[model samples]
Target: MENARRTTLADVARAAGTTVPTVSKVLGGRSDVSAGTRTRVMRVVAELGYRGRAGRAVPPDAGRPPFVDLVLSGIEGTWANRALSGVERAAADAGVEVVVSVTRPPDDAWLTRLLARRLRGAVLALVDTTPDQLATLAAARMPVVLLDPVRQPPGTVPSVGAANWAGGRAAAEHLLALGHRRLGVLAGQRTHLYSQARVDGFRSAVTQAGLDLADDRVVHTDWRRAPSRARAAELLRGADGPTAVFACSDAIALGVYDAAAELGLRIPQDLSVVGFDDLPEAEWATPALTTVHQPIAEMGGAALRMLLRLGTDQPPEAPREELATRLVVRGSTAAAP
Candidate 1:
């Protein structure tokens, strides 16, 4: 009952002006105590951070090695799986454990639960962080590293990502080299930093080739396939639709394929397609997708390593590190018809 490290029922009893037995009885769901006394003790137990018999039975940090949270915006597709694998592998090598969670940004429920636990740090993948959230983590001294954050994070936070702009330019240059003057772009959410970076790079390349985005097609849509398909199909319906299209993600590229199929357009022959991320499924497509290879797993590992350094009171090698991205040529694109 004498817990020096944390609050105990004895401490709760003194604070609540009651006896330890009564506090214990209330926690145990016993009905012997008067309602008024039980209510006050229960409130004090919550305030004092005293858990019942289960919590007091063992030390909170005892026998449990430190772990980091691998928080994902959502486990949407292969990207999340690959990111998780990379972090898990790196954590395993570093003698740390990974606790994965799917959470939404600006939500305090996850923050409250996270703050209550004993975690080394957290790696947020494709998640947005608010000023308040960053302040809370800073106040709690919980280290964090952003992995391809949806938006640009504050300069103070460390972040890891692939070279999105270069990847976009590479995709654009590839299409342009293949004799395609008219190009199209299927971008993710308009506010997504990576998405916009890719689009900007793509435009820069096309402009360097004496083409203008004003004459090209650019559709900003959801990162998933269904919405992309609808948008791409509509764009393709135009008489001057692009001969080649650059999709910001592999998922969106697949949707373009669906659109092409719906419209009876042949890959590379009728319409050339290029995608980003170069996910596993890209190779198995009807005509293997020519895409930009973003080191998704490597980014996760980098974030994990950065978080570990921060947890150890060491500064990261850099505030933001972007791994190189390269274009992978395949069957999806060809010289314009």
Candidate 2:
């Protein structure tokens, strides 16, 4: 019996009447290739039953453990901890290790260091990755997935996040249902896409209810406890203070609690609060926080799964996957006084 020869990129290119470099470009997911050319090249690749070079296939052995890079903006808060836990759990299930990295500035040096590791892929959580950084990853043929990116990444990149808009609307509706017309929102940084969606959704709900959300009532603060606390203090101390506050994150909501304390306001009794991202702190708060339960851990796990798929040369089913968010009623909210 004769042995079948393994298919090669050159063979596929010749069959498609294209150059080897063109086939390589198409397989590399480069944007420079025209849509028609890409389709044609992929068709030829399929018809030839061409898999990439043997080195490209995922190793079947259990000898050396593979690692995926999990990059974050910072790893200091409950939100970060929850997300990291999810990613680590998923990675464990897949028998892969996670190398967690914090990209404060997300500079080229970080990319360089990551590339040096020769990781299988990378999952970036709450990190605002730049185009150049993405280009470097692409050049290295490394798959990348974004988890709650501060901004929408390029169309080619896959992302996992929560339904921030719906969560925001739910928060506003909950407060509105409690007969709280005067409301304030402690939003995260303006640059965060989720933060903007949340604010927009909240604003939409308020407008639909024929209520006005004044500009001053919507304060944008850093996504940290201390900064949010300071901003909340400003809102709470204002003469036209809000009777109810909707914080974009539980951390921010905690800040609201601090501000209320400084101003001698009691939770639910004096000031009603609603928060997003139902972190552990939400349940531990004095009055417990009524918050939108964003599946932070699920998002992390989903991103890791997507990265794994990409590592195997599989395109994601969707460019963006948004986990659902639900409102969890807790002890912090009450009817307006």
Candidate 3:
């Protein structure tokens, strides 16, 4: 009775028009199935709500655990969560489970211990860890795909990152095109390669356009909400303030908005602002921020797929993927006052 009603391998086999042993092989995480058979079995398993795990090798039992484990460096903020959502969605479609963990201090020891367990592959969310930290993880011999990984080594590890430098240059050029010579840039932490690249690109654009970037015009702040607000306020209060501002991220741009409101300054009319990482909330900002849009969700999904492909000894399917970025002009930016 009740056991017969419950969905089982035999039921799935019947549903997919396959033999019991064939269904069992695919459900047991074997790669021997042809593409067509694997797809059929998975569709039936998903339809029947059959779940199996993947953290460790185990005899096939009802509802096995997930097979893939996901490692995340930082789990803070809406952006991180949204990106993880994309990865999780892809993993679920493949019948894989995802485990997310943060990489805290003493990076190597913590990472090594974490990776000692069985995992199909790993992904670093934003690559905030130090070079030494990356080297230690690479030595573990596990297939690793890094999102926004620094390009210092530029070796054969599958790296996926945004075209940040181009975005920064575009931001600067936009302000310049609007006749904004006195411009200020709100930069994120210098240690992060993404931030560094943005700063470099902005500086390069200023130089190329024959505009001077005064030392005081650029303010570097941690990618925190409060600190960016305070720093933006300090810069805005200066005697010779900028006519326009470029914030490295939307989070930092939010702080700038707060500071602007406190100072009774109007957007575009008084100061034009541009931001990076056109997050979902960017359009909803008070004046609707003008920003550089990065494909955060797509990047997450692609990184996960690349790692999964590494499960076998296949050739690199699309190594070193660099997604492009574009500038979205909106109410927040206008001709300098």
Candidate 4:
């Protein structure tokens, strides 16, 4: 008797004249559905009390295990992996499951997929979001937290990131302290908020030392290995090239290594290299890289905890949180040749 009265996903779909997946999407808080369809499906869900009829996500037979979505642009390399490890560890400790979703180009395919389930909140890692998308999530009463937002996100969107400017400054300071005057920069996308902050920080340190980045000295790349390698080769091969290079990421620093090997320039001896992010790869490199440590894993964990707090309607006093960064000296830097 009770089973007959239960409002299943199918029941809402039938009442709304849509498929179960569409109803699931609407209930899940996805932005892919048409306005009319979302409205109709939600109306049926309200009328039938779909959530109350059964339970969130799974059936009543199994206890409701709340979960959250960890959405990313891509989970390809060490940065993403470190972030994922942190989030997963946090979720494990909290006894909640995490659903990872990836999408590129900001199409919100990950969000669409997330909406098909009953999730408590979301953490967007290195993914951009639009106002329209935020409004859709708002309509669904979903809380979102950004992990290292591409730019300064709206005040309404809470975010967790490291102290990028400080890190960049520290990297430059280290190089300057080592007596390297002429320097090159391998920066990430110039338009990125953090990227700009880092560069500005490095520039600030350089300025304090009575130096500045030359027009041809700074090369902005897409933060990939092959392209960065090519760009570094060009920068190093130039006449009167910089004796030291500040790579925005450890990945980029590796490219500098490749370029040096190809150009017959020995690290620290001929070409000093410093990198950011202090990824494990930094220590594993042949000469061990000097770098700024951004606490990438901690940022990921912090974002998850913030998202959970938002889920419980307990937001932090500050919406934007930034962790600190520090410089770790290693074998890669030396006095200018």
Candidate 5:
């Protein structure tokens, strides 16, 4: 039997006839390595089976770069994935390395540690951090960017987000144009600023059209599938319920669709529905879903850029950025009964 090539660090070290630690140190890029020793060790490594870390193998770029940190919530969600991709792309273009941490509501100890370490920049993805957390972030003197609007007054910190209000208005206008006079609104969590903005915009357009928005017509939901579906089921089964529904999110709209089916109502013919957030699944739903499209990718990119700028100076600049939204008409809506 033939023996396999017995490649070992000793073999390479022997080829150079140097100490084992010298070869190991040179391969590890230890600064103590003499130039002549480094060249010899590298030559032996090329002749042997040894490989170095890829990042070390690549030559360093010549430029001054900024460091960024991204603190996101719910990394598993579809929307969060899309937003993260955008942020990564922007950070790469700026030659900044982004250190990311997943953050949750009501706890900020992790943030305090990161701040104590003195990072160059940080961004908060659409998470509900407490006012105390915001104050802590401010006191830490890190340049912070809020992903979605917070309950705090405007101009508190730089924020870049979708024009949720415009999205709401667009959704309402689409339904109204379809002759949907009697409407039902399924709102998301009231604590969420974007959700509240959407609800207010919908209500504004509905009232402007001279339609009476009865107290019963609007329902507050937690934006989860089971609860929203249960609430929608009740509304659909009622005798005087709305002929049209405007759900604040695609998740809520899905519940409405399920509820309408349980009540034996056909979309468009018997009930019209409009939704916010044109998620990928929106178009694939039965009868399709008419919805408002927010520029989710652009929102993420803008937030990253804004945070990068803020890191240079920690002054409290309330930069309010609004990305445009559009109405997408699909098969789910039609003239009201």
Candidate 6:
């Protein structure tokens, strides 16, 4: 007996007068489809006897795997590793798999790849989604959750992040408590929301403590070790250099360490230092960096859970979730000498 032809997603889409991704979304139980379109797709699916895979009749959950995509611009350091670990743990607990993708400025080809895979949802780490991309995902019924977004997303999009402002304030307050009146700040790029918030919070704390942070004391640099180190050396080599410095990130803090060494200054003795994002490298530093614990792993886990909720057609309690930040006092900071 001859084997019967199997119905495919493309065939269903053609019959429904829609695209493959739309049909995939309809079969995947995505909530982004309009009611009318969903109904039409369903009718077409039934009429076509569309078997999702392996020539089997379409099961309720047949179109896509029970997995979500964890997308990042780059995964080069401890921060990304910690986040990815958390996501993996959470996904395993939920009996779901995670697919990690590193894409810079995700384009239509990326979207096409995702649609082809029929991914359930996505967790974006420092990855900005454009309007066209968002619309495409919506049409395909794929949900997305942003974790530590570089830029603030639309109000409707759900996001999970650390309390950057509070973390900055805490860092400043720690330095102030140590009697460091002359403070220097290595701020990240102003275009990034988190970077701006951290800078604002540090300024607020400094101003409230009756100290002036001169423009010369605050230098904006790309959040990289090299640039940060260069800026730190410049700030420290000045005529009236600060006794204490707060770096916006641990990576930048590493720069501060290099700069201090180059200047023959001892950490916490001649130059107290603090950094944000208590990455593992912070603890391993010679003086164990005094830094803000931003809960990078927790943020990742939270973002994954939020995406799962979205995939289930459930609305999140809040559009934005800010995890708490705390100060981890280590050997790098001390009283002004």
Estimate every model's Cα lDDT from 0 to 1.
0.82, 0.83, 0.75, 0.81, 0.74, 0.81
- List ranges where model 3 is wrong by over 4 Å: 1-66, 106-113, 150-154, 311-318
Worst 10 residues of 2 by lDDT: 53-62
Q: Tell me, by lDDT, which candidate is best.
A: 2
RMSD of 4: 7.8
lDDT of 6 by residue, 261-324 (tens): 9999999899999999999999999999999999999999999988877742324343788999
- Over 1-337, each residue of candidate 2 has an lDDT whose tens digit, in order, gives 9899887778978887889898776655456667667556656655665656535534434678888999888888788898999999999999999998887572334555565565788898888876645644553456789999889787777899999999999999999999999999999988889999999999999999999999999999987788888899999886669999999999899999999998999999889999999988999999999999999999999999888877545353537899999999999999998
Per-prediction TM-score to the true structure, in the order listed: 0.80, 0.80, 0.74, 0.81, 0.77, 0.79
**Candidate 4, 34: how far from true, in Å?**
6.6
Candidate 4 structure quality by residue, lDDT tens digits, 1-337: 4556665678778988999888657756667789778767656655664442222333212586778888888878889899998898888888788889988773545656666666778888988676555544543556788899887776667899999999999989988988898988999898888888888899999999999788688889877878899999999996589999999999999999999999999999999999988989999999999999988888988998888777423233438899999999999999989
lDDT (C-alpha) at residue 6 in model 5: 58
Where in model 6 is the C-alpha error above 4 Å? 1-65, 105-109, 311-318
The superposed Cα distance between candidate 5 and the true structure at residue 322, in angstroms, equals 0.8
Clashing pairs in 2: none
lDDT of the structure predicted as candidate 1: 0.82
Candidate 5 TM-score versus the reference: 0.77
Q: What is the lDDT of candidate 6?
A: 0.81
- Candidate 3 lDDT trough over 10 residues, lowest sum: 51-60
The CA lDDT at 296 in model 4 is 83
Q: What C-alpha lDDT does candidate 3 achieve relative to the native structure?
A: 0.75
RMSD of each: 9.1, 8.4, 14.9, 7.8, 17.0, 9.8
**Angstrom error at residue 42, model 2:** 28
